[model samples]
Target: MTALAGLLVLVSLAALLWQRQHTLLTYFQQEEYDNTRFFTAWQNVRLFDLRATATIVVALVVIAAGAPFVGVKLALAAALAGIMLIERRYRFKKPLAMTERAKRLLYLSFALTLVLALLTVVHPLWAIVALQLAPVTLVLANMALKPLQTRVNEGYTDQAKAKLARLDPVRIGITGSFGKTTVKHMLAEILEASGSVFYSPGSINTVLGHTRHIRQRLQWSHKYFIAEMGAYGIGSIKRLCDFIHPTYGIVTAIGDAHTERFGSIEAIAQAKSELAEEACLAGGTVVVNIDVMQYEPFQRLKKIYDLRMITVGAEGSDVVVDAQETDGASWRISLHSKLGLIPDVTYDLPLLGAHNVTNSALAVTLSLVIDPEIADQIPYFTKTIAQVPHRLQVLDTPGSALILDDAYNSNEQGFMSAVASMDKLAKKRGGRRILVTPGIAELGLEHDRVHARLGEFCSDRCDTVYVINPSRIPSFAETIDADKVTVVEVPSFAAARAAIAKDLKQKDVVLYENDLPDLLEEKRLL
Candidate 1:
């Protein structure tokens, strides 16, 4: 039985992962790699991979060591069912068109399992021992071979996605530093308001993640597919546009989002503008944000292309939004239409800062071109658009501390905006602002300078500062006097949480700013 279990495990592994290096690598290198999500889904299915395989292996091994017949047979049948069920899970994750390979593999693995079934039929007691040992041994083998998965993944590139975009019927590429997600969500919402829309959810911008998403889940009903292209590298956005082949496009704004990865803002801008260029070559309309400072300054894009031009923001834009802010509480949302004001009324919004308003405005501008009705519907999306999770999400703690969980990985603009918001709120709530931040990262050498500025900015807003990463604290200390800034340095989030956990009082506002990734080379572990 243990031997049978081991064999079943091997068959399942082969069926699911092995002998299909081509398919895996091809999907891995695509621009919109949705395989990361698939990988996550696969991890969920791996439970069965272990249970079925291990149970049969243990049964066989135990039988080899001499176990009961009844136990081994039951385990063998259960293992078989587990294998089938896990494959079913894969089908659920992937679309019918792309799941052919997985389906075929599953069939082959199930056929191999028949050998174990025959073995169990011969001698049940021996089968049980065989199954037991099979699971234990195979589990160790899978663990040992895990590194091969990483190597398999690394071989995938973004070039293939570009190849597909050349064949894409209609591609609408979108890229920017800050508001790609907002524009993606807005475009999806507007398009979905009328016709079938195919857009990836959230920020699945890697090669493997996007390709699998495009291949596995992209529905046939998709007429106008909106893709939000994001980047941390030079050619990432261009590669994605090559895959998407968007006929219509938008670039919201370029800022210091991933300048650390690309080295400079200009490099970042060029990467972002690649979307417009790709759309132009595809004979698609490129919606240029005239309001975005960086893209406008680049200059050359304003001259190139025959007909790929749609101006948005500030100047000669057909669809325009006029915003008038009133005392930091709400902004009047009005759209310029030939028929006149579309929802030309000011409504109170509970959002934190001007960035949210700008994001909504960009949505309105971009949505108007391809989708006019939903362009008018932007005000509604604005009202309904949930504040992005963990970005300025203010909560009331038990002690009534106004806990502002702005822990979503922040940039200079975001951090500054958060500080400004807290300052406004501080004035409104009549309480001193307390900030617990680890400061900004991924700015390369600008880390120290950004930290210094943040420290200076915080000195004006925060009554107390709970610093998380102490190595950057000296840069901050240089910006502000130590006496004015009460800096409590904790080595870890856990420790910071522990120390600051006791500092909350009624009406004390705390901002948790800038959570860093765990993989920093000069990492400080508390």
Candidate 2:
């Protein structure tokens, strides 16, 4: 029995570690901020702390039922209760959206573990492995159930469908690795002048997200619907396209966003372009960024299929935004037509980076068909965009210091834009710029190397740098003065807050670039 207890303890420790990773994974789902916030593994354990307490009761009941050292089991239950109390007292994070479900599942799993532990007295080896995997399996089971549960709420979506049906709206489906979210936002903004529509929150690309948006917020009067569909491999976007059956498809630039699963950029492009294929079958227009080399085949796909491909680029674009560095004008904003006629219209777009010009251009042209009045809203859209709530939001604080919160830049181009945004602010303010980031992750070797170059870019311009995670050691090496850059080891969020509070002083331009989100939520590399 003592030997079994010892083995159980080891298995529990491993389970604790595994749960931490799982917890971090949950927080990472909404990881849109950099140094301002972070997801810690400890929070995972804490959120599921209730399971630990319930497990003791369950264990006690089972052991008592089995008549195996009743007093010891009772004492063990009491000890477990006390330990859980202490654990709850020490835990330091807010309850996440998945907390309630996790608690229920954890309790059930611990009960199972107790049953298995009893079996371990006879079958030791299998029990140990079972104990470690119980909580994980519970989580997986819960995950499997959520989609089914969400689908049952199909009546709400039917109302949305009815409303959209009344409006006779032309729906557009946008999908890609990096720019899909931005593109969706852009499309909504550009199309608002034509008729009423919703942007569907930040990265509302999932099936549930779309379903909820359509079910709840969709109005009968709206003329257009823009849905951003995201996928990991083949058939994923096809599933989404099948659901909405978009009239127009927008394929943003594709890269090695999910190379680990997709195998290569080619595979990623192939997976993403399915939306275009479906849109063509639906007799809908397919708008693609021809500037993207992967879109070269899309240009060809335009000729063969029903796909009406609208291409945008810096040199020759239907709608373009040319830039001049008044203080910081990195992204050019212009308007044109396919016939190569400049519309002599301009927008002071709040969004930075030259790449957004293409994004905005593509959005503007595609939207005009559904929204001819969009031309009037361009200037208003530019002002209201407000940096997409952490994507290059520049704030001028007291004491002559400026803070550009580009917390959502976890992609290759996004990282570059952050560097440029920081430099722009630095040049304007004439103060030292400070970059605080964990750098981007899961971008495969190409993106990792790209981040290293970003480190070099920061080194050239910024005066001080702070990296939240030690995983960016290669980035630190690329720095101008490796010693000058501070590397903070982050195991949890509290430690990160303390470190940032200590380093941040007045009179400095700070750019919190990106924080890598854990997988299971996105096909985007991070």
Candidate 3:
């Protein structure tokens, strides 16, 4: 019985750890292993999660009451097994590649579990109680492994830096709360005409991600390298800047995209401004979004780095977007620079949303600054700029449903812009506009207010709104009128897709807004 209990505890703990490894590591990485945030996320149990609570309580009680050792162990093992089974059934599993740091942490966690299990020889109660410390064990392991992980990361980063120094391409770093990827792709398209351009692919914006891209994909022949820099806290972008040493930079727009992790808008701006500051320090020109110039940080940046700064926006800026009008799945934009008013440049962009015009304007300004010879090619490149995979990409469906896919890293501003774009498309196609969303998540303290405002916005814009998650329904209910908008509640994405297919017809436009991964509670079927 003692050996059997030990085996059960070991197997159950292994299974649980395997399941939670990715989420645990992600939080650890994002929060920088801050105990406060780690513990908060660790213990963020759902209110009225009676099943989990009851299981924990009963296991403790049994161990405390000196129940048969095997029985108590069996109970704990059964509880863990139940949890693992439920997670496997309901959770969407993505292919998570464990980093060297993650692997070290995992090994440490397993060793801790084994050490605790060995205490079963003295008291089986020790093994039973060890299950409760799963989260704590991972935290302890991370704390232990951090120094070694840092050394390994630094070693690889140094090699990447050496490679970068040898090649010395014209590096342009782009950072902001949003639109960095779009701007990166836009700049890449324009600059390709000037020379061979290598931009960081997709959302590979972190320090390690950038290092890997540089070491593996960066080529000697590439004349321009655009690095998309992202940050979660202060100095994060500065760290990236220290490595790549960009010759030019663009601060797209300052917003509340990651304001939750940043704690405040000021902190977010400070973090994002690191890119421009570093670029200016390196004697490189920095392009500032004129709209965000109203912010104090950008104002401060301008005061200190005025010579290296160029502003772009709708009006009253160095690079001006005189007009932007959409004509059935394409955008017509007119741009002017300090040099002079360039002819009105119109392009059939695969992208949607007026916000993209701002991104495009920044890209165009930077391209002209880099190579004035590409001035005439601006219209051609803008017309041929391919659609970014998920950001406002249009999908071809076998059915007549026109699907506008904007289901990645959603923010309040982006969501509103998508809604406006959807409204326009529906009007042109003479179809009913439908919005299918689980609503946005990860706004932290601003979650309720943001969703409430989103609901209010959807009430007026969408003909039919299908809300997937029930947790968001209350916030939406606060502002949305059920009678005014045909609101349907769904338990899963499958169900939502089914409903759309049943009602979809030719010219029907369905805008899939912010999609949450299954790891988030908002994606769960209630």
Candidate 4:
């Protein structure tokens, strides 16, 4: 009986551990295998949440009281069942992908779980520790695989470097705290008028991610390779610049987008300047938004580097956006440049948001730098340029409520713009403006201050606000006018969706501002 019970506990625990592994790996992948972030997220699990704390306490009491009365095997079985219930409560918004790297980590994690489970068989008390080892096991596996991961990454990077040398595509690196991805897509579309353009598809900005795409997809016919670079720290963009060696660089804007990761806004600006420094070194023309030119690092780079600097923005820029007028579903934008690269012209942009006018100007400016002849084709190319999905994308639902999805990667300016867009659409459509968001992430010390401002802005524009993960942004609710706007706090997106679905009416405009990953959305021990 004891032997059978021990085997059952080990087998059942193995299954439970496997389930927990997926949650860990999903976050690990989302964090881009950053061990510090992964472990920090792990440590933040709400282990003492009412339900979890109660489950643990009951299991402990059941084991102590019922061990001698019900016999050790049955008591242990009951405790295991209780722990399994708690594990099952955890459900992630996104599932883990079983990639080659994930599989290696999964294997090592399972092996660690087995070793701990075997000890539980000797004394069931070990089960307590065994079941909670998922995060630790994942950390150990990642630490063990670091050397192999580094070597593999280096191999792919080298191959990509060699391939780029052979093909020699006009490399253009775009980096910003925000708007980089949008600009990459816009530039790729505009450059298509010139020749074949191959961009890092859909935020694949990392060195390895770029290397993988370059190895498999980037070819000889690609006239331009647009790399959208992202940075978590000061040297991150510099390392990517060393990898791609872009001839052209665009700093779209600098803001408090990832101040948590970079430590400060100054650090972020310094990191984004790496692309400009590298582009200047390569003797390539650099296009910068006037917003980014305010940064001291960019000012220093402009003074030191003798590279062509093309500035684009609303005003006082080389490429100046003269005006942006909403024309029903599309926007009519007028852009003129003092640099003479862009001819003064007004073109219809089939995109939403006021910031997109600046984004389009940035792309158009960079596109003209490569080939002056492409200017005549801008009006036609701008018409064909499709809106980047999930970045102020308007969803088509004939009879349903209108949804503006600016949910890809959220920044403060983008969020404000999205809200303003939603309000305008609601007024135009004669409907109530609804805002559903989890708020922005990685703001760190600025979290409350930013959210208060956002809440104040939203209170005026939004008729009703659905705040997902309300605890993360308490100031959002505090600032909101309860009488003017209905503030509904929901624990998860699903809950918010349920509430919205119940109250949704035709002509209502709902703006899904920022969809955070599973890490920010849910915190659980399992």
Candidate 5:
């Protein structure tokens, strides 16, 4: 009976580990396989969850009813709890894909779990303790595999570099706190009018991700390769620049998008300037938004790399944005070249938010800089620019409600711009303005200040606001004028959708400002 109870405890422990591995891997992937971040996120959440606690109680009650011995009862209960956990479904906003890297991490994590389960033979309490320490096992596994992961990354990066050298396409690097992905999409489309352009699709901008794309998709016939460079730390963009060696770099406006990771605006600025610095050192022409030029590090880098610098979107800039006006349907922007290389032009753009106007202008300015001859085709291409998906994208609903899907927006500036657009369109159509948001992420110390400002702005523009994970940004609801506006606090986006279904009326405008991943939206326990 003692031996049988020990065996049952091992079975339950194995089941629990299997279930926990899935969730750990999902967040691990979301954190870009960074063990430090994964561990930090793990620590912030509780160690025990409601389901696990309930399952244990129910299992113990049932086992105690059938088993006479205390040891047998505990063992039977653990076996039953394991059975319950094995069939558990973990919900994630971004489901875990069993990619090659994910598979490797999963395998290594399970192997570590198996070793911990081996201790269950000596005492059943080891299994219970291992349940709480599961997150630590994953962190340890990731840390142990770092050397091997580095080697694998190096191999792929080397292959990508070789392929890039042989093809020798015009490489253009785009980097900023926000709008870099949108600009990459816009430039890729505009440049495609003239030649075969190969831009990194979506936000796949990391070293390994870009390497995979280059290895798999890059062709000899491709004339241009647009690289959207994203940074996790100060040297992150520099690492990518070292890999691609961009001939043209565009620095969009720097902001507090990832200020938490980098710690300060100056660090973010210094990190972004790495692209400009690298591109300039390579004798590459760089187009920078005038806002980025304010940073001291950027100014110093610009002074060093001033030979091939072109400023845009401000007075005395090489590519000047004179005016930006939007009707309810689209935007018409007037821009002129101060350097007189490219012709002055007015862009009729079909996109939302004033930031997009700036994004489009930056894309146009860089496109012309690459080839002044394509200036004639620029206006038509600008007119035909399709709205980037999920970045303030407008969708028509079956009812009179207009859906503005800005689910990918994360910066305060972008959020405010979206709110402004929602207000304008709602008033133009004589409709109620609605907003759904999880607020912004990685704001660090500026989180409260930013959300308070957004709340005040939304109080005027929005009639109905659905604040998801309201506890994450309590200041948002606190600042809103509850008398005039209706603020609904819901746990998940699905809950908000259910509420909206009941109250949505004709001629209503809904803006999903920013959607967070499951890691930020919910508190998960081991």
Candidate 6:
């Protein structure tokens, strides 16, 4: 019975480690590790349900009372076997592979659990309780490995910096609350006309991710390297700049995208402005959207840096988007800049959303800064740009229905822009406008207010709205006029898809705004 309990404890610890690998790493990576966040996340999953908690508690009590160990051993073994079975059933749905540091932490956790399980011969309760304390073990293990991880990361970053210096590419740093990726891709496409260009792929905006990209992908043949810098607080972007040493920078737009983490809009701006500050300090030009200039910090940045600042927007800017007309998934815009390089320029943008036009304007401004001759050929280069996936990407269904897949990263501005674009497309097709979303997140204190506003905006534009997690937005029902629009609450995306298949017609337009991962959902663990 003792040996069997030991085996079960080992298996249970393995299962728990596999399931919580991502969560553990996320907590470890936090600026200040949050135990509350860790516990809250663990409690939301079935593997750490109340039954598991109670089993460990009972096992601890049994050992403390010096009762016959057979009953507690069998109970723990059975409970652990059940959790392993449950975890195995859903193992195929696992998320991304754990990082190297996370794998190291898991190995440490396994070693510690084994040490505790050895005590099962004397007291089986020790092993059982250790299984339940896997999270605490993970925390301790992470704390021990942090210093070593930092050293390894610094070594890798140094290697990347050495590689970057040898390649000698003209780096352009891009940062914002949102639209950074879009601008990065757009600029890459436009700048390709000038020479070979490379960009950090996907949302790999972290320090390690950027280091990996520079070390692995950055080639000597690439003339322009675009780095999308992301930050949760001040000095984050500066760290990336120190390594890459970008010659130019662009601040797309500042908003409440990461206000939750930074705690205030000013703090968020300060963090984002680090990119511009570093670029200017290197004697490089910085492009900013005029829309964010109303903020005081940006004004201060302009005064302090006294850098070559190019502002792009519809009004009050050096590079102006004169007029924009959207036709389906494409845009035709007239752009005129005070810089004279791009004069009364008319271009076709193969993208969606009005915000995209501004993003392209920034790209255009940067391209002109790089090579002024490209201005005359802006129309030719614009055609080479394509719509980025999941950022208002238009797809066609089997029944000729239009599916607007904007389900990637969600923020207030991006969500509203997609809704407006969807409404326009639906009007043109004379189709029923359907919206499927779980609503936005990460607004922190403003989560409810932002979601409420999104709900109100959908009430007017959508013919039928399928809210995946209606409870996520507590103020949703109050903001919407149910009498005017049909609102369907779904428990999951599967149910929403079923409803769409049953009701959608050929001319229907379905806008999938934002889909949250199951980890963020609120539910009973069992």
Which is the leading candidate under lDDT? 5
Worst 10-residue stretch by lDDT in candidate 5? 45-54
lDDT of 1 by residue, 1-526 (tens): 6566555544543343222222322222221234343343234323223444455567667778877755655555555555545544431112233343334433343333334444644654433333333323223333444466456544433443543454343456777776666567756765665577776776665556667666655655666667777786778877776555677788877767666678988888888777777777777667665655345433566567633565545544533556676666456656554433232323334567666565665555555555556644455656655566667776765758687778774677778888878777777778777777777655765767777887888788777777775665568756755667677777656667788768666776778876653322123110
The total number of steric clashes, by the backbone 3 Å criterion, in model 5 comes to 0
The better-scoring model by lDDT among 3 and 4 is 4
Pairs in clash, predicted candidate 5: none
lDDT of 3 by residue, 1-526 (tens): 8788868865775565455444455555545557667666554432112343456578768778988878887877788778766755543434335766667876787677667756655764564445556567778897787788789889989989999999999999999888989899999998988999997788889888888888998999999999999996898998889888998999998877776788978888888888888898888888878977877878898999875788888667877775446565667776676655333344445467888888888888788777877878888888888888778888866657789888884788889999888988888888999988877766767788888998888888889988877665469755777777888888656688898988788888898886765444332211
Candidate 4 residues 73-101, lDDT tens each? 45545555666667667666666778899
Off by over 4 Å in 3: 1-36, 45-90, 338-348, 442-445, 470-473, 491-495, 522-526
RMSD of 3: 3.7
Give the TM-score (vs. native) of candidate 1: 0.63
After TM-score superposition, the amount by which residue 119's alpha carbon in candidate 1 deviates from its true location, in angstroms, is 39
Query: Model 6 clash tally?
Result: 0
Candidate 2 lDDT, tens digit per residue, 35-149? Answer: 1223232232233334444555466566658756545444554554445344333322333455444454445545555555556446434343453445455445445546654
lDDT of 1 at 22: 22
lDDT of 5 by residue, 299-374 (tens): 8876876647778877777677865566766778877875584677777888878888889888888888788778
- How far off is residue 131 in model 5, in Å? 0.7
Off by over 4 Å in 2: 1-79, 86-95, 98-111, 117-131, 139-168, 305-307, 317-321, 329-332, 338-344, 472-496, 518-526
- TM per candidate comes to 0.63, 0.76, 0.87, 0.94, 0.94, 0.89
lDDT score, candidate 5, position 239: 95
Off by over 4 Å in 5: 1-6, 47-67, 70-87
Q: After superposition, how far is residue 16 of candidate 6 from its true place, in Å?
A: 5.7
Tell me which residue pairs clash in candidate 2. Answer: 318-336, 320-334, 321-332, 321-333, 321-334
